[model samples]
Target: MAIQFIKKITFNHPQSLLSFRLKTTSSQYVASRFRDATFEKFMDHYKNLLKVISIQDLILANPKNNPPSVSVDFINRLSQKLHLNRGATAFLRKYPRIFEIYYDPTLSKPYCKLTPTAMQISIEEAAAIQNTHPLVIDRLTRLLSMSKSKTLPLRAIFKVWRELGLPDDFEDSVLAQNPHLFHILDAHEPNTHLIKLVGTTPGHENFTAAVENWRIMECCKDECSVDRTEMRYSFRHGFPPCMKLKKNLRAKVKEWQKLPYTGPYEEFTNMKKRSKTAVMEIEKRAVAIVHEFLSLTVEKTVEVEKISHFRTWFGIDLNVRDLFLDHPGMFYLSTKGKRHTVFLREAYERGCLVDPNPVYVVRRKLLDLVILGRRGLRSGDHKLSSSESEEDDDLLEMENDQGDIL
Candidate 1:
C-alpha cells in the first residue's frame, strides 16, 4: 500500500492521485505501527504489495521500511543458485545410491562408493555366473537390494543391474512382483555381514536370516536352497548382542565439535548436486584451507583416495571433492541445509589428485568403466552366435581406423 509499491506509474487521472495518496498514508502509518515482534502480522501487507512492485526494485528503493530478514525473493534466488527444482526432492528420495552416498564410513556424512572392482569382473562373466563367488555375491546382493525399494532410483537400479549383466530390467520386474523390497532395504543395515562376522541378537535374527539367504544366493547361486534355515542358524555369531549406536558418525561429529579447517569450509564433501556458484564457493574455501596447510610446510598429508560422489545437475556429472594420492588428508564438499561448501581435514584418508583437475579425470574414468564394460558384453554376446569371430573383425577394423587417427 506504500506509494513505493505503486512503482513509477504516471498518474493519468485526478482520481488516481487521490487513491495513491490515501494508500501511501495508510502504508506509512502501518509500517510505523509495525514492531519487531509482529513480523508475522505484517507479512500479508507486504505480500500484497509484492504483486505490483518488483522485489529488486523495492530493495533498491527501500520500500516497506521494515524488510523481513528472509523474503520470498531471497528464497527464489537460493533455489536458482542451489538448483533446487521440483524434481530434486523426488530424485533425492528415489535414488538408493543417493542414500548410499549418505552411508559414509563416517556414518553421519553422505557416503557413496564407486565399484571399480565390479567393472573389472564384467569383462569375464555375467553377474549371474559371478554370483558363485560368495564375496562377489554378497557385494552383488548389496547392490541389488538398493533397487528392490520402490523408493529407489530406477536409473541407479538399472545401471547397477546392467553392470552386473543380469537380464534387461530384471530389478524393475522383480520389484513389480514384490513391492515390499523398498521398506525392507530402507530398514536393513549396511554392515550386516561384518555384524554376522561378529554376532547377532534375538531382535536381529530376522536381519541375520535375510542377509544369510542373500549371501547364499550370490555365493552358491542357490536362492531356492532348502537348508537355508539351518545355515542361517549355523553362521549366527551367537548371543544376545547389542548394537552400540554411539560409535556411529553422528556421535563422532558431535564429539569432534567442529572439524579442523582454515575457515568457512567443511571436513567432507557429499552434496547431491553441485551448482557453478556453489562449486566455486567450495573451491575458494578449499583453496584458502590448502593455502593455510601448505604454509606450514613441515606438516604432511598422508595421501589416499579423497572420496566424492558424481553429482549430476542439468545432466552433466562432476566429482565435487579431492585429496592427495598418498595423504590421509582430504578436501571434501558437503551439502547441509541451504549451504554447500568444500571442506579440508588433515586426518581423513583419500588418494587425492593434487593436480586440481579431478572433476574431469574422475568422470571420464567412470564413463570409460561403464562404456567398456557395456561394449565387452555386447561383443561377447555377438561372438557366441556368430560364424565370423568378432576378435578378427575388431582387428581388421582397428587396422583400417588406425591409419586415419594417426
Candidate 2:
C-alpha cells in the first residue's frame, strides 16, 4: 500500500495557528488521553462530558433578555429528554455560573436561571447566530444535497438545526424565505415534511469532489502496483494505520473499497437482495455521507445519536459507531460530552478546529466569559460588572467592534 497522506484540500483559511495552538496543560492532557484510549473508553468519557453540556445548552436555549427561571421539575424533565443519568437539579445547584438556583417559596418550586455572566454569554450568542445565518443556509444546503434523495426529513433536520446554527423556526424564517433554493414536501404522515433542494448547488459539487477525491486516492494505490497480491492490502491504505494488526482486516477493507461509488442522489431500494458489491458501495457512501455532514457543521462535530435519527434518509444501515471505528483517519470520536459525538479529524489541530466558522469564533468568546463567570461565582463575587467581565474574556479587539459582532 502507498504510504501517502491525503493531500490536504483547503476548504477555508484555518484560524491563526498561534491563537488556536494548544498551550494549556489540561488541554494537552485531554488530547493525550484521547489518543491513547480505546473507542469504548472515549465514548464513555464523552457521555459524561455531555451531561455538563446539556445544562449549558438548557440555559442557552432560553429566550428573552431576562429569561424565565426554570423550575427543578423542568430540569428533571430535561434530564430525561437528554438521557442524562444524574439529577439535573443537583447539577444546576452545583454549577452556579451555569445555573443560579433560587426558590419561589410561595409556589413551592426551586427555580433556576442563568447567572449574570451566562446571560451575557447568551446575548452575545444571539448576535453570533444572526451573523452566521447566511453560512447556516449554505451548510444546510450542503446537507440536503448529500442525502440519497436530495432531501431530508424535517424532524431530522430540526434535531441538529440549532447545532448547525439555524434559527429555532428556520423552516419558516430561513427555508420559507428562500423559495428558489428550497421547498418542503409533505410525507405520508401528517406534520412530517422533507426539506428538498430545488436544484443542484455548490454543495452537490463539493460533496462529489470530496467523495471522489477519497476514491481517487484509494484507486491510486492500485494503479501503481504491478503485483496482484499487493492489491490485497490496498483497501487498508485509507484506514487508520492502527488497524494493521488485525489479520485479514486489510483484505476485507480492500474488497469493500473496490465497490462502486454511489452518489447521494441514487436510490438503494432493494438493499437486502442487492449483490455484495452493491451493498458494500452503499456502506462506503454512508461513510462519505457522514464525513460530508460533519464538514457542514459550524463546529465540524455532531452528536452520534443525532445522525442515527437520519439513518434511513441518509442510507446508512450500520450503526453510527461502526462507521467511526472503521474510518479513524477521517473521523475522531471525542468524549467531550454526555452523548457519543464524532468530529472530522482534518478539520482539527492541537484540539482546536482548524476551519472554524465565524459564529464559532464568537462562541469561543462566550465560552471564555462563561469560564470567567464561573470563577467569579465560585469566589462568591456576585457584583462583577459586564465591562470587567468583557476585559477578562481575553478576546482580541477588533477595529469595528459593532460591525464585527453583528
Candidate 3:
C-alpha cells in the first residue's frame, strides 16, 4: 500500500541555485544530547491535565446534559477508556475546581459535574475557537503547503487537530466553506480521504518558514552577532545548563549552523540522498519541517507518535524519533506519559509558552483550574489543607527532576 502511494507522487523539481552551495565537505558526528528540566515539568503537568480535559468533554457531550452531571458508577465502568490510573471517583475528586461531586436526592447517588468556573471557562474556550476560525484555516493551508505533494491525509490532520486549534467539524465548517482554498478527495482506502491545496502558485512556494521569520527578527535587533544569511539557515538552540560541549563538537555545531539547506516551504526534489552532504541537508530540512509544524501549534508541542503518521505524507524518509533525538538543541523529547512529546525548545521559557495564542490562553485557564485543585472550591466544599498543597508541589518538583539529563 505504501509503495503504491509513493509511486503515485512525484517529488521532482528544477534544481535551485542554493543547491550547489550546499555541496561542500560534510563532517559526521553522533547525535547531540541534552535535557531541559523545565520542559519535562511542563509535559508532566499536561499528562494528567489532558486526561482530565478528555473526561470533561465526555461529560459535556453526554445525552443527559440537562443537569450536565454523570453518575459515579457510570464513569467508573469506563475507567480504562478514560485512561485513569486511579479510580474514577478519586481522579475526579483530585481536581475539585474543575469537577464537583454532589449527592442527588432524587437519584440517591453521587454525580459529577463541572464547577461553575469550569463551565464559564469552557464557554470562553468555545468563543476563542470561533473567533480564531480564520487563523485556523491559514494554519491548515500552510501545513498542506509544506508537504512535498501539497496534500496530507485527513487521518493525519485529525490526529493533530486539537493542537492545531481546528474545530471539531472543520471538514464541513471550515474546509467546505473555503472551497477556493481546499479540496477533499477520497483515498484508496475505504472511509479515508486526502486534503489537497486547491490553488498553489509560485507565491505559495516562496512563503517564508517560521524559523526564517525568527532569524529575520533577530537580524533586525542591534545585539545580533550572526550574519543575516547565516541566521536564516541556522536554528536557535537552547541547551541545558549542565551540558558541556567539547571543542570538536563545538566545531561540528558551528559547521552545522552555517550549512545551507532548503526551507520547509521550499522543494528539494532534485537532491539525491546518496552523498553525505545531501544526507545532512535532508536531515536539516526535516528539522525545519518539524520546527515549522510546532510553530503553528498552539502549545508548540505534539506527541512524537502523532507526527509519525505524517512520515509518508510529509516525505520525511527517516525515523521521526531519531530525527528529534538527533537535534536536542532545537527540540526536546519528553517521556512524561504513555506517549513521548516533542517540544520546540525556543518557543518556551522556564515552563510557559513564550508567545501564547488566544486559543492557548483560554485553554490555559482550564489547566489553571486543574492546578488550583480544591483551593478553588467555595464554602462547605471539599478542600485541601495548605500543607497538602505544599506536599503536592514538592512531589511535582521531585518528578520534574527525575531523569533530568537525556
Top candidate on lDDT is 3
Candidate order (lDDT) = 3, 2, 1
Shift of residue 359 alpha carbon in model 2, Å: 2.5
- Write model 3 residue lDDT over 1-406, tens digit each, in one string: 9986455443433363346444543121212245466776676668888888888877787746666878888888888877787889889977877888889888899888888988898888878989998788888989998888888999999999999999878999888998888899999999999999986433554577788887878999998887777775688987778777789877887888888888878776857457988888888888788889989998899998898898777778888888887777888887776777888888888888888899889989888776665553334646545676667766875664675423
For each of the candidates, the C-alpha root-mean-square deviation to the true structure, in angstroms, is 27.8, 15.1, 10.4
Per-residue CA lDDT of candidate 2, range 1-406, in tens?
2333222223323553334454456335435432413334334333544455566666556655245566678778877777655777655554565567777868898777776766676577677787777777777877776666788888998889866888767878789988888999999898898888886444445444344554456557746553444432222233334444465765665556555566554444545658877666667777767876776677777888898887887767787766775666567766544445787767665445666766777656544443343433324555445666555543533233334324
* Poorest 10 consecutive residues by lDDT, candidate 2: 1-10
Q: All models: lDDT?
A: 0.30, 0.63, 0.80
Name the lDDT value of residue 77 in candidate 2: 81
Instruction: Please report the TM-score between candidate 1 and the true structure.
Output: 0.19
Q: Candidates 1 and 2: which is better by TM-score?
A: 2
* Backbone-clash count (model 1): 23
Q: How far is candidate 1 from the true structure (C-alpha RMSD, Å)?
A: 27.8
Candidate 2, superposed: residue stretches over 4 Å from native: 1-67, 77-86, 103-109, 200-260, 263-277, 334-338, 365-406
Clashes, model 3: 0
Would you give me the overall lDDT of model 1? 0.30
C-alpha TM-score for every candidate? 0.19, 0.65, 0.83
The alpha-carbon root-mean-square deviation between model 2 and the true structure, to one decimal in Å, is: 15.1
